[model samples]
Target: MHYAFDADQETFRRELATFAQKVLAPHYQPDDRAGRMRPELPREMASMGLTGLRVPERFGGQEADAVTTGLAAEEVSRADINACYILLVAALNADILVGNASEEQLARWLPPIADGSALSALVLTEPEHGSDAANLSLRAQPDGAGWRLTGEKTSISMGMLADTGIVFARTGGSGARGVSAFYVDLHDDRISRTALDDHGGRAIGRASLHFDSVPVGRDELIGQEGAGFVSVMQGFDYSRAVIGLMCVGIAEAALDDALDYARTREAFGGPIGRNQGVAFPLVEQATRLAGARHICYEALWRKDQGLDHTVAANMAKWFAPKTAGEVVHQALLTFGHAGWGSDSPQGQRLRDVMAFEIADGTAQVAKLVVARHLLGRKFAP
Candidate 1:
């Protein structure tokens, strides 16, 4: 099977890598320190069409395929991990809106996101329901022709700053079947936000959203009343693979630094890389990350070809970030105390990669999915 990128994809990769280094890398640390996204970043990314890579052409987007979108995710995260979340969260939410929203709803919301006039975030995980999203307690009660939503969602990326967001709330009975999705304006008076000072990926700004009496009309409800869980859960299969690529990018960056240091730094009249002890672990990590990258792209390619990719996606999700964390740790140790300093991005890379281990789904949860898919759910965990 062909493994290399096509000519156009290669060109896209080179250009995006240059853009990330020249633009994103410079502001990454400052923005992280400030715990906020740069005000101009969203519009800048939109100008590059990065924000709407997966959005449809009718909505002013390039309508990139899943493989291309995954490639862009890897390059972007390689330069600045936190900024990658903007693309990830937006693309997932855009897909949801495209797939489920009515024609008028898509017309209204898609343009703003496509043109970079607005930023979007997904509101799913609540304090009480991290992995148990199907049982989220957020309440949306019918009020005449609309619904009034009231609940708190925590650990949401870009929750405090998104101009718009998609929220899942309970509208029927209990569990997954009762959940429904709503499109809401973050600026509504009934909505209040509090940003969290996370250890890493601070620019993405995880936050808690308290929605009290937020009014949404019937038009705001996406798809049928209880189909929202299925809609969003389907998106996760794609997102998990993309997240794997993102982590691989971070790990590659860290390993590159360590390799550079090993080749140049001398100890006892020789370069440290000359020692197998210093070099073998790096070799192992390189091998692991390469496999992870292949699986991630393979999963995306399968998705583009309308093939079943659940097993590949979950495998990548389970392995990539875990490998990334291990590689980054080794890289830090290879730096020989230089990596421990706050001045070194290696530490930040470590903290950032740690989030992916739990973000989209934990390794345990991902394994469970793979297990269930391989064996029938009746016999699987």
Candidate 2:
């Protein structure tokens, strides 16, 4: 049971952190204020080989393992939480393309995705259904050897400006087995998007995507008909673990800020950190963050090893964001009055961490996944 990153992984982490500090940190404030990514950011990420970490190297991706991917996500989050969305969405879409796309399709999409010439999103959640994904009501009907889709997907990361996306829709019967995935171009006139006023991760632009009879060619279909749900759910097992790492990274950043305050800020006579009261909460949060980080990497390691890590993945997802929120809150309080100001990024960091509590899967939904695995599906809520 190794607990540390390999020499290679650690080297990569340092490199990515340096890259993020130089590229992502400078734009964080302006992008957050604008509620969308800077136009040049994606191209920058691609030039650095940061966009398609999971795609095969032959197609220009790093072909990274789960652990490497998690490391990259953590380093990126530490710079700007919103920028991490670019990596996460790209990973999800890459999983779909790698597992189900035709060789020709892979050749066409992988390079642009790897190079950041194309921005992408994984579109699954709709206005009516989120965790209950099996029952999504998006309709994908037959149209002369192709498909025409019409539905509304809300709160989608990068929806307001993605160049492409992998959209899930119902094609056969009802429930999970009926779902199919398609690669769709976001520029189509039939597709319209509206940005949502979200509390955090504003630069990512959570938006509602309206597909009005959007045409999808037969070549765009991913995997066999009625098999899309299986592919996507499998991909989640990989992503949920990485999400845990991303949350931990943001919390760690907040902790770093608090530590600086504790050591330098004066109270009574000496630094406030000299007192137990100001330092204990930070200590507790630090401990929790360490544990969460270990769990996140453990799950990711299992993924790289091709082990069945379902329980570990769910446990990481269920606990990491919840802990991150608590830890960031403690950091905010430690900052005293300074943290409350809109000028300080602490408040924004807290809001951004809160989004993860509901993003991939809510804490309760993650618990249900774990329960169903351990106690059997019949006994799960």
Candidate 3:
């Protein structure tokens, strides 16, 4: 029944919004042109504790709850959706590590991320096996007392600049059981990176990472050998909802601009917003965005309360980005000509929001998860 943010949460959300507008919004369009994150971007966001939102205080982090983390995604993405990618990957990695890593492992691995000395990537996808991550071919050959990884991971967000990555590789027989997670130093000479020029989110430095005999000792093992898939997958249920919020944030920003245009721009000697044609589509999109936001927050809240949120999370994953894309497209149309320009956020917002529909699994895959949860596994797709 509670529909509003608590006093503290509201205050925090406002502070984040202000920071996003002042520090991140200015770079939103420009960074997309630069095709890489700025040197100070990591540390600046770290200073705000955004890069460490999910880490425990002992690790120099805020240990923020899932809802708080979702709020950060929503607020930050409104100004710069690409900047939110850093927080997204960081939160996912922190959650996975905290849930699975040994105490010693946590002690060593968590600090650098919390302190902004490290930027993290979840290395789960390969070119051949994306949604079917269980079938990934990246091999982690057993060495003396460790393993040597040799394979390629493409479509990696932050791969170009990440100092650390939790790479999942095949270690045993076929399928998911064969995979294990390794916390690897991406800066090592054994690893070579090819930066991807993405359609959007270029600021996050998406890339392909190739590992040729990269060493991973026993200490770098994240959890029990075969548990990596489950650990990482569990984190996704929550991160999906966070991504929904991020997608909604940019759409909301675009909507705001469209509304502004409708109010001031004259058409037929009157404000265009006065016409139902211009206003109704915006209204419909607004309603859809509102519903998506609620679902996203509900998923995050369920995770915070120790409830099974898979259904809500997947629903948000599929619904939010799709809704956002529609909303941004409608908003662009509202501008008529101004929105088509590269200078306008509408075009960039549309491109950026498009990625969420595909990243973290496509809408079709997310719907399939919800169907499986709603119907019995045998009865579902």
Candidate 4:
């Protein structure tokens, strides 16, 4: 029943928070405005072994547990929300590769990511299949000695910049059983990436990938064929928890900023924070943020202990992002006219938090998962 973080975890959190504030924060505004990923951030994260926190030590990683990774994600994201995006992608890719990739594939892929020489992005969502990933129309056909994959994946984070992608395509027939996962190199002539614009989390560089008969060897298969859906779901289970942490970070930052402004900005010759109208909303926001944070950490802890946490993870993923959006919206309102300006960081925070509401899974989809788990399929129509 211990609720507090251990000394080592606390130390890790403090170190990450310090690094994020001192280094990452300064780069967030300019890089996000330009829709560019920070060139040095990935290398810096690699230097600290943050990119490979969940990877095996044999693969040149620290082999840290999931809770530590979640803590690091929260700290970095508190300074700059986009930092969470990078960290989560790395963690998710590492977890998936470690759990499913063959020994030779791991040898080829894991070290570069650990050393920051390579970046990996998960390519599951397509233009046509957002939540219906099991029925993705992307086809990967047997071609001579290997496979030729042709499909278009849209709204993928780090899609343009990633050295490799773990893509799910249909190799069999229809539905979940037919899906298979493949690790494809983006450098192939048949693969093309086009950067997408006009979105929140602009610093992360989402894109659309067009694969035209891209060649992949048999070793690229992750897990067994027809087992791809299960692998992808497992990846989501890991990733959504981190995404919940990201929401908590962003909400905390926004609320802190708004509170600071409320305490300082004079209204009617007194601080606006003195008024119950302004103060109560702030209090409510803080309460919601705290609740969401607890849920996120509990889910992470359950995951680290290898407990069945699908329900808790889904709950956090559903509630945290929506709560964050509401908190940021309230924060923006507290800033008045200043919040509406594009020049203000609050507006950017709002847009960034909004994306999370739909990122890993929509609030509705998450609730569906929770409902199904709680009620069971035989409950009712």
Summarize candidate 3's per-residue lDDT along 1-381 as a digit string, tens digits: 887888988999999999999999999999888777888988888988899999999988989999999999999999999999989999999999999999889999888898788999989889999989989999999999999999999999888899999999998889888899999999999999998878888888678999999989999998999888888889899899999999999999999999999999998999999999999999999999999999999999999899999999999999999999999999999999988988888998998999999898889889889989888788664
Residue 202, candidate 2: C-alpha displacement in angstroms: 0.6
Top of the candidates by TM-score? 3
Q: Which rank order by lDDT, best down to worst?
A: 3, 1, 2, 4
Please give the lDDT score at residue 375 for candidate 3: 86
Give candidate 4's TM-score. Answer: 0.97
Q: Estimate candidate 1's alpha-carbon lDDT, on a 0 to 1 scale.
A: 0.90
TM-score of each: 0.98, 0.98, 0.99, 0.97
lDDT of 3 at 21: 97
RMSD of 2: 1.1
Q: Write the per-residue lDDT of candidate 2 for residues 341-368, one digit (tens) a residue.
A: 9777788888898999899888998899
lDDT of 4 by residue, 165-222 (tens): 8888999999999999888788888888899885788888789999898887788989
Q: Which ranges in model 1 have alpha carbons more than 4 Å from their true place?
A: none
Cα miss at 9, model 3 (Å)? 1.0
Return the clash pairs for model 1, or none.
Answer: none
lDDT of 1 by residue, 33-135 (tens): 7778898888878877888887899988879888988999899988998888888887888888888998888989888887788889889999999888899
Question: What value of lDDT does candidate 2 attain over all alpha carbons?
Answer: 0.89
On lDDT, the stronger of 3 and 4 is: 3
